[model samples]
Target: MGTYRFDPIGEAPEQIRFRVRIGPGYGSIRIGVDGIPQEWGWIAEEVADYRGEKVTRWRRSQALQDLEAELKTVAQAYNADHGSNVMTDCFMQAFFVFVESEDPGRLAWRAEFERRRRDRRA
Candidate 1:
């Protein structure tokens, strides 16, 4: 497992409030935030080249990092728009959507759909 910490936005230096951890498994990677496990599965799609070469573990690790970065951006956007921090459950849901298609657009659509559903309930 690899652990990483990020300081809160516009906060004092060395003051960290967020943490992300990743654990690699057999053809899968588990992500956790602040010690809470968010999601774990084969989120990255397997790719083949003309020579029938498949994606390597390093590529999968790269994919995990890319996904994490994207999720952070989305979470920041959500916080900015809602004036509140995004919950782990929302991240988990987005991660699940990503696992389904590995497409950021699909994840965005899912988030919008969820927001609309919540608005209807409110």
Candidate 2:
């Protein structure tokens, strides 16, 4: 099993800063297909950040799409080769947060951990 957390960094002027980290070897294995920087989230800033630009800036340029497409192709190899035995479980934020109520589950789980930690200390 692995764990991930997101954190924001120093107050910025023109840009917001955030970091995404995966534990258990510090995401050294790099299980994902896309170029999600260890210091950033799932979406690569190179592409996702400028998606609103409509191919204007460097991020919206053809190069970015080419990179994203290549990454998708590489990732597809996993499913293509191991179609029956494999499953890449994924969920959208709204789906997991609102539809499935992951927040409640996470809270209940954290509460249990806190209780156990307190018990151990006692």
Candidate 3:
């Protein structure tokens, strides 16, 4: 488990910080804004393919897409309240830093994890 922290807006006040806590799986991930945990959950949706077959799929609600969205919302709110011109990209860059830091040996871990999941489904 790792807890990564970064400032959404550069040189912003300490109260405007963000923290991401990641554990073994997607379910153990969490995001915090200003030390207050934000609400996040898994998302499921039905999708139809070209053949018109519909299937339900689940995704991590706070992964890249949802994480960026939530961070943008927070950044927008902060800009509106404080009259600061902070770009949403700043948060994403900081997130990428954390991702890069965790990348070492990640391929092996991911392969093993996927194999275990596949075995369970067999």
Q: Which candidate number maximizes TM-score? A: 3
Worst 10 residues of 3 by lDDT: 95-104
Evaluation by lDDT, superior candidate among 1 and 3: 3
Instruction: Give a tens-digit lDDT track for model 1, residues 78-119.
Output: 332323347643332222211212333345578899999999
Name the lDDT of candidate 2. Answer: 0.33
Of candidates 3 and 1, the better by TM-score: 3
Across 1-122, the per-residue lDDT of candidate 3 in tens digits comes to: 97976533443334334666653543333444432122232355689968899965544333434444546555344332323336653332222112111221343478899999999999
Task: Tell me how far the alpha carbon of residue 10 in candidate 2 is from the true structure, in angstroms, after superposition.
Answer: 31
Which pairs clash in model 1? none
RMSD of 3: 14.5
The alpha-carbon deviation from the true structure for residue 73 of candidate 3, after best TM-score superposition, in angstroms, is 11
Ranking by lDDT: 3, 1, 2
- Show the colliding residue pairs in model 2: none
TM-scores, in order shown? 0.22, 0.22, 0.23
